[model samples]
Target: RWRIGYAPESWDACLNWARARKIPEALLETAGLVVRTDDGRVYDRFRDRLMFSICDEQGRVVAFSGRILTADKEQAKYVNSPETPIFQKGKLLFALDKARRAIIEAKFAVVCEGQVDTIACHEAGLEHVVAPQGTALTEHHARILKRYADEVVLMFDADTAGQNAAMRSAEPLLAAGLVIRVATLPGEHDPDSFLKANGVEPLQEIITAAPGFFTFYLERLTKLHDARTDRGKLQIAQQIVEWIAKVPHAVLRASQLQQTAMKLGVPESALQQELRQYRQRDRTVATPAETTAPAEDPGHPAETLLLQLMLTDERVVPLVQQQLAADWLSTGTAAELMRKVLRLHAAAAWNGHTSLLGADASDEAHRLVTRLLEEKRPAPERIPAAAGDCLAALKRAALERQFQAIKLRLAQPGLSGNEVTALQQQILDLRRNLDHIPRLSVWRSAKP
Candidate 1:
């Protein structure tokens, strides 16, 4: 158990308590239990607060997170002890010392966004809960979690900041090759309030029903963007492709692409082609190809599609080659890539993309080289029809552009009542006009 205790209203209470026990005042300063002002006065670092000891794996108290009692505007809601010899905030997860056995038994860890939520879960018989104290979930935290469990369930608040934290956390977990699921509380409820409001069973039920990272994020993207139109569909597809491309394994990437394409009602070949283009373009950039929440990318999706088709399909490669004079593409990045792919094929140097640009590509070229070289890829004649679809997507994109414009206006500080209603109605009409993309609710349940 953590060394749960309290500090009184008066700053001197801790100092006096230490003196009565004959604990040296200098030791308190060194331990980060007290702070020395520039004017030479010494006082407790955590006053009028509930103090929870942060412990190491051996259950040694190395730091403290102090929760303030009042809603004081000037002060932070929580205060933590400064870095000391034993504790580095970013390097430790709260309650891990106590949660280790429970985590091992559960075979999965629940990561909460708050220390109080961690305590609340523990009290309600969910003993495997932990929190990232004073920092976001890091690679260090991921490695630590992997020691006890193979998966992490992120029980973050429904608020924007908490949801964003949950999203950011998936990276380190994936990079560490650990399975990640996200569980959310309704409305403005944090885990502590949700537990008290609904009791443990309902809260536990939600966590048990949390979805894997892909299903979780894809559903979120559906809500945030219109899935009814071609533009919206491609936007969502591009975002999913970005994250899928980041997956460290090739076979895994292909499998994810197959599943995503199925869900989007698109050909697996198209998504595979999209990912191939993402890889080629990603290779040339100096910036890290990190995928956060998918935002709008204005890149021409059709041109990239053609380029990818060329890279993988010998049929489509000549289609792009014959029409090199026309410029439907905005950037030469993908065009240059197709040319390289062509030369690679002609020279019989058709190795991986790494051979040309020192970058990794999807497995379609490697896996289906026999199909491609044999001229057996699907629908090479429809390459021109795709141009028609791009033109139609442009027409439909006007609605998407209008929808996004309304969203931008909604973000502005103040608006008149009629303006807000008109905007809301426009969104309602757009929603009705667009085909409703079904959200996935069937998720694998964890142990209750």
Candidate 2:
């Protein structure tokens, strides 16, 4: 159970208690339980407030969230504990210590937006509920949840901000390989108030019948952007495609793309062809002269070899789609042609270079496709191994480029302390990821 309690109105009350126990003032400052004045005097941080002790997974108290006990409009409503050696807001969820076994038993975790909502859900007999501690969802939080359950159901408040939070939560959760579902309570009712009004049965029924996160996200997206106009539809497809890219599974990505095309009333071929990669403006199609920057080696000859293999077997199309990320190949002739091939394959409309040349695709793409089809290819049995090597090289190059981009950001001016820490963490993750990728043994002799 959570250690819920109250603090006295006297500022000196906690100081006196700590002094009697011989607890050092510096320790209290480190624990974020007291504030030191400019003149070096100290006082209790939480006075006349209800304190909710935030704990780690093993049930050790690390920090507190103090709710103001007064109705004074001038005073801030909540005071949160700062990050310390023992506590990180991004890494700890509010009630996870009490709900881990419940989550494992249920095979899913319910993530609410606040501690009160989590406590109310538990009291209502839904024991698998937890919450982020005064922060947004982070990848660290996602890793912790993935330990107990394979699926996560987000129940945020029914407001624009809540809907946006659910949208933001999708990237981390999906990247962690956990299935995502969402339960949107009617009107302004959060889990706590909804349970209080309609009782447990009705609330449970709503949560049980909640839709998958993709469906929920698409609905909200349509509402936020105009779905009827051409420009609006393009924006919507781009956003949805970006979300689908975060999904780690290839079959799931294909299925979601089909759904996106169907829902947006665009042809599958068009969706695949026109879906610009995520954050396009931030990245340049790498060129040889920009060698000093974080640019992909666009001239790598593996691009042509992969093209020939794809022309050799239709199976290579999906393999490329499954393994190589979008925007990895420089947006040059061979790469663009390769994308066209993938688009045709996914649409089940792949006839040959003839069909590609006839469609509204670029003539350069058509010429490259035709040229690749004319070249001799590796044996059918050997195609997978060859394609895997090429894909590995492509993926490695992409990761290296990404790694350098974050490093570049670390060198920028005027970044806050938190931003610098986040960039450093991303660099570490990228390095770990790069180490796991198989080496590009085939491209060992290729030039820059």
Candidate 3:
């Protein structure tokens, strides 16, 4: 697990490696591993650097992050692989492959600002650590953490920029159902430096004693604004209202509103009035029609429901495989998704919802998966009935398609006598099959 690999530190060796491996110039350019000059010559993009392999949750290296071993005034200290098939900076959290299980065990995850900070945390025996790729945390990153963590402890640098990053990331993490705490390091030090100077005990104390988001927000906001004046108090109250809106739960939002009002020394009713006005204005900007959820497409429910069952319980896969054909999922995105899930299942690579996230899936697929996850799932006791309903629905859909196809063939001009008889027989058979597939009840109302 601790094995190390090396990359060439010079352009010559890199170029030679590419040549020997028969790598095409276009591929190199597309991967952002090579640069093309005006004269049409291609050269290695990285040289004379220490390399770090950035991997996904499956421990497969999808990209590289390079640190310049020797400082150069003219060049950046670090370089990263460009967005390719397997690399998307916003979606990746460094060391997740190693940190996720630890995070689950700990029930909390510590997010550092960079790779070095993450490595330092791991070395300090804090294995529940991950880092954004030299960028602010993204919603995808937050969702990934929320899969295993109830809380995220933000341990970015103890500086203005770090505070700003924490504020920016809090909304997304909170939206993903994570409670956030900000670990205030002593003085102006990142996790790596603090760990080096004071050792792990002090760092642990800071993390253990870290304040929740509301307390940290109040403290930081008071320090940033002149909270003593009436105008300043009003401004602070407005800011608090804006942040409280980001809390998705109505109960939590109401509690936050009361807390904010108490902190701002304003009556809770006044803050409630302000929030009401805010909602009224927001509604005015977006009409009811515009804000309404889109109408569900009735065509793909069977396929979608079936895929949901497969994902929730892999044990049901054989039942599905025995009962349904691939063509049953033929009408929409479900077809491709079922294939992908089955492939992952066959290889024992499924990790629940985590398996569906990453560069391997398209944006549409990610959106679909997100939608599926957000939908209210059946209770454990109802799974068998749900699976049966989905299976029956798929069979009905498949038979309908077969009947429609046979009907179309029979309607074709100048069909031979044998062809007409064969088509009619197939339609009759499809009708008989469709009739046998028991009617679907409201999935929740179905029996075992």
RMSD of each candidate relative to the true structure: 22.3, 14.5, 15.4
Cα lDDT tens digits for candidate 2, 122-146: 9989999999988778877887677
What TM-score, computed on C-alpha atoms, does each candidate reach? 0.61, 0.65, 0.68
Off by over 4 Å in 1: 19-26, 287-448
Cα distance off (Å), candidate 3, residue 400: 27
TM-score leader:
3
**Candidate 3 TM-score, C-alpha based:** 0.68
lDDT of 1 by residue, 111-182 (tens): 998788999999999999999987889877886776566789998989999888988888888886788889
| Ten residues in sequence with the least summed lDDT for candidate 1 | 439-448
Q: Report backbone clashes per prediction.
A: 0, 0, 0
Task: Evaluate model 1: give its TM-score.
Answer: 0.61
Better of 1 and 3 by TM-score: 3
Q: Which residue ranges in model 3 land beyond 4 Å of their true spot? A: 1-9, 287-290, 293-448
lDDT of 1 at 333: 49
